[model samples]
Target: MRTPPTIPAHLPRLAARFDLSSEDLGNCAERCAARVQRLADLWSHAGTPPGQVMRTLRRTAKRHSVYMPQKDSAAECINRMSDPAWWRRALRKRFRAVELHAIQTGAVHRHASPYVSAKALRRHELNAARLAAQMDGLEAINQTTGEAVPMSDLIEASLANPANRRAALMARIKGIETSALAKSHVGLFLTITCPSRMHPRHSMSGAPNAAYDGTYPGRAHAYLSRVWSTATRRAAHLGLTAYGLRVVEPHHDACPHWHLLVFTPADQADAYADNLRAYALADSPNELGAQERRFTVKRIDPAKGSAVGYVAKYVSKSIDGEGVDFDSESDNDGRAAARRQIAWARTWGIRQFQFFGVPPITPTRELYRVSAAGLPGLALPELHQACKANDYAAWLATVEAHELRLGVDYAERESTRYRGETTKAISGLTVEGGDLTQPLSLVTRCDTWRIEPRAKGQAQAPSERAATGSDFSPWTRFNNSAPIDAKGLFPSDAPRAKTEKKGEEGETAVRGSVLHRAPLPGAGRGDWESARPAA
Candidate 1:
C-alpha cells in the first residue's frame, strides 16, 4: 500500500535531451531527491530565473561524456548524472565567488573587486603565511652526499624568491642588451590587449559589461596567447627576427594584457611593429577603441635608459612590487597590486613572463648546481665555466658556438624519474634537432638529491662556498635546494611521496612528506627555471 514516486514535470525534457527514458529520469530524480532539492535551493537563493536555471541545467546535462556518440554508454551517463560531483561542478561553472556566496550564506555582500576580490586576496595571504610556517624548520638532504641544508636557505638559492627571479631576469636582459649592442639591434617596447568582448567587467567603473561574451579569465588568456603565437609566426614569415621578454599583467577587472620588450635589427623594427599590430587588431577590427587602444609600440632609447630599466618596474610590479609606488591601471599601491597580480595569476593558471628566440638556460642553471669539485672534465667545459661564472655575455657566446637557438636549432630534453624510484632522478638539458646522439647534445644536470624533514633541534648546515672561477655564489649563504614538488616533498614530475597507508575518507593519516614550494604558473610546461638570453 505504498504511494508511487512523484517525478518533476521537466522529466520529459531531460529524458529527451539525454536520450534516456522518462522512467529512468523519474527514478534518478527520486533516488537523488536530496541533491535535486539542494540544487533547487541554490538556484532559488541566488534568485536565478526559471528559464536561465533550465538553460544551466541543460548545459550541465550536455557536458557529460556519454552525450558524445560512441564515447560512453547511456548506463554510464545515468551513473554520472546521479553523482554529486556532476551537479557541484556544473554550479561552480555557472557561478563565481559572488553568486556562490549568495547561495551559501543567504546574504549578498558587495565585492569591490579592483584587480582581485578582497576575499580572494585575504585567502591568498593566509595560505602563503601558512605555507611559510610549515617550511620553517624543514631541511633538504642531498641523497648523493648526505648533505643537509635548511629548506629556507635552499629556497633563496633557487629562483623561487621574487628577489632572485628579478635578478635573474635583469641579468638575462642585460645579456640580451650586450648581444643587441654587438649586433647593432634596436629595442622596441610593445603592448597588446584583448578585445572588449573578452572582458566581462569595465576597467574604470568596475561595472559588468552587457556585451561580454561570457569568457573567463583563463580562456581570455588563451586568446591572448593565440594572438601572440599568430603574430610571431607572421613576423617569422616576413623574415623579421627579434628576441626578448614578454610580461603578462592583469587589468583592473582582471583581463590580461601583454608588455613586450624585444630587440630587433634596426631595419626590421618598423616592419616587426606593423606585423604585430596587424595581427592584434585583426579580431574585432571595428570595435570601439580597437583602432587606437589595441596595440602600441615605442622605441627604447639607450640614452634615456637601458632596455632592462624600461621594463624593470613591470617585472618588479608583477613579481614582488619592490620599488613600485602605485599602479594607475588598478589604482592600487605596489604591494597590494602585486598581491592581486599573484592571486589573479594563481587563480587562472597564467604564465606571467616568458622569453623567446633564446638558447635554453637549463644548462646554465644545472652548471650552477654542480659543486666546484664536479666542475672539471664536464662536457662543454667553456660553457660550464661561463655559466658558473655568472657571465651571461660569455655564456651566450658559448651557446652560439654550438649553433643553438630556441625554436630554430634545439629542443629540450627534460629530467625524468624511472618507475618506483623516488631517490634517483635525472636533470634536464637541451638537445640539438631533438636528437640525443647529435654532437650538440649536452647533459648539464649530473646530481641527484633527496629531501626529508630535519630532525627536531637539528643544527643548520654550514653554507657551501661559491664555485671556483665564479666571483659570487647565489647559494653561498643557503646551499642549493631541490626543485619544488606539489607536496613540498623533493622534486618529482610524478605524484608526491605518500604516507605509510592511504587515508580512508574523513580519516587523518600522517603524511611522510612536507609541502614543497609552489611552482610558477602553468604546471605542465617545461623550461620554467631557465632559458638563455639571445646571442
Candidate 2:
C-alpha cells in the first residue's frame, strides 16, 4: 500500500500568503497565458520581430496548456501528463515571476525580454526546480530524523571561518614584500617538515623511547632553524636579494608535518631548492643517534593554480570509536587477546575526544524534514520575507506555495520517476584561489605574485649591484607639478614622493625640489592642505 505525502508544517502560512488552491492556481495560469498572448498580438501588429513574437506566443501557449489541467485534476489525473512538454511548461509557469523580475531589473541579458525569450523562462524554471530538489532532499532527511536543520548550520559545519582564512593569507603576502618582488615577476617561499614515529608502549605507558623520547620531536628542528638562518644571510650570493619564509605545522594522519612558504627570484629558485635538499639530507635525526635524515621539496606556482588550502588534519583520537589501536595484533593469540581487551575497554566507557583541526558538524536528514514539513505552497514574496526573517521554516513555506501555485500535477508525477541529466554546461570563468566548491563570484580580488626565470638576453646593468639601503630610497618619487597645500604639503594623489638620491661619492643628497610627507600626521590635519611637509 502507498502512503500519502503529508503537507509540510509551513503550509498554513503559505496558504494565507497566496491564493494557491488548485482552481485559483489554474485561473492564474490562464491569466498569465492570456496576458502573454495579448503582448504577442500587440508586438506582431507593431512590426516586432517575427522570431520574438512567435517565441512568446508559443511559450505562453505551452505554459498555460500544461498547468491548466494539472491544477483542475487530481494527482492521478495530472500524473498521466508526464511528457517532456508538460514537465517543461509546468516549470516555466512555476518560475514566471523570477523570469519577469530578471528581465525588468535588467540583471540578465538585455535581449532577455520575458515576452520574447522562451530561453529565459526555461532557465529560471530549471534553476528553481534544481534548487527546490536540493531543499526537498534536505527536508526529507530532517523529517526522517524528526529535527530542524538550518542552512546556516550546514555552511558553518562544512566550511572554515572566512575571517581566519583571510588573515592567514594576508600575513603570507605581507612577509613576501609584494611590491619589491613584483618587479622580478617571481614569488619564493621556504618549506620545512619533520616526521617522527612513536612506540606504542612508550606513548601508552608514558615511558621515553630511545628514538623518540617525547623530547626534541625526534627530528632536527634546531638544525633546520640554523640552516635557514645561514641561508638567509647568504641570500644575495644566490641572486636572491628579497625573500620571505613562514613555518607551519599541518595536521595529518595523527601526526605533525612542517610546512614552509618561501619566495625568491625565479632564476635563483633552483639554487635555493638544491641547497635546502642538501641541508636536509646532511642533517642527522635528533633522537635517531647517527641515522641521517632526508626531506622532500616541491616548487609550487600560484599563477598556475598550484596552491591548495592549507588546512591541518592530524591523526588524533576520533570523536566516535574509530581509529587505530596500537595494541591490536594480527597473530591468532594476539587477536583473541586484543578482542577481549577491546570488549573490556568498551565496558569502561569512552572519554570525550576532540580532533586538532575542524570537526565534522553536518546536519542529519531528520532536521530538514522537520523544517520542510512546516512549509507548503509558498509564493516568492513570502519566501523573500522568510529569508529576511532568517526563518528556515518560513522559507520552506514559500517553496510549498510556489509548488502549489505552479500546480503539483506534472512536477509531482515527474519528480517521482525523474533522474537528473548527466551533462552540464561549462562555466567560462576560472578561479585562482580557494577550493573548487567555493563560489567564484564571492571572490573580490586576487593578490597576484609571480616567479619567472630571468631572460637570458637581459644583461645586468654595470651599476646594478646587490641591493643596499642607498640603492632603494625610503621615499618614493613624487610629481611636483601639482599644487602644494597651505602647509606646503604635496597633493594627496601624487604618484610618488622624492627622497635622497645616491651620488657618485656615495653621499645622500636631495635630488628633486618635490615636497614629501612625514610618516605620521600632526593634529588638526584634515587633508593635504592641513598636513605638514617633509624636510
Best by TM-score: 1
Query: Over the stretch 198-276, how does candidate 1's per-residue lDDT look in tens digits?
Result: 7656666665566666555677789888888998999998899999999998876777799999999999999999999
What is the TM-score of each predicted model, taking all chains together?
0.63, 0.24
lDDT (10s digit) by residue, model 2, range 380-423: 33543443232333433444434412110110111222232121
**Where is the poorest 10-residue window by lDDT in model 1?**
508-517
Clash count for candidate 2 is 46
Q: How close is candidate 1 to the true structure, as a TM-score?
A: 0.63
Candidate 2: stretches off by over 4 Å: 1-165, 171-181, 187-190, 195-210, 217-223, 236-239, 250-257, 285-293, 306-535
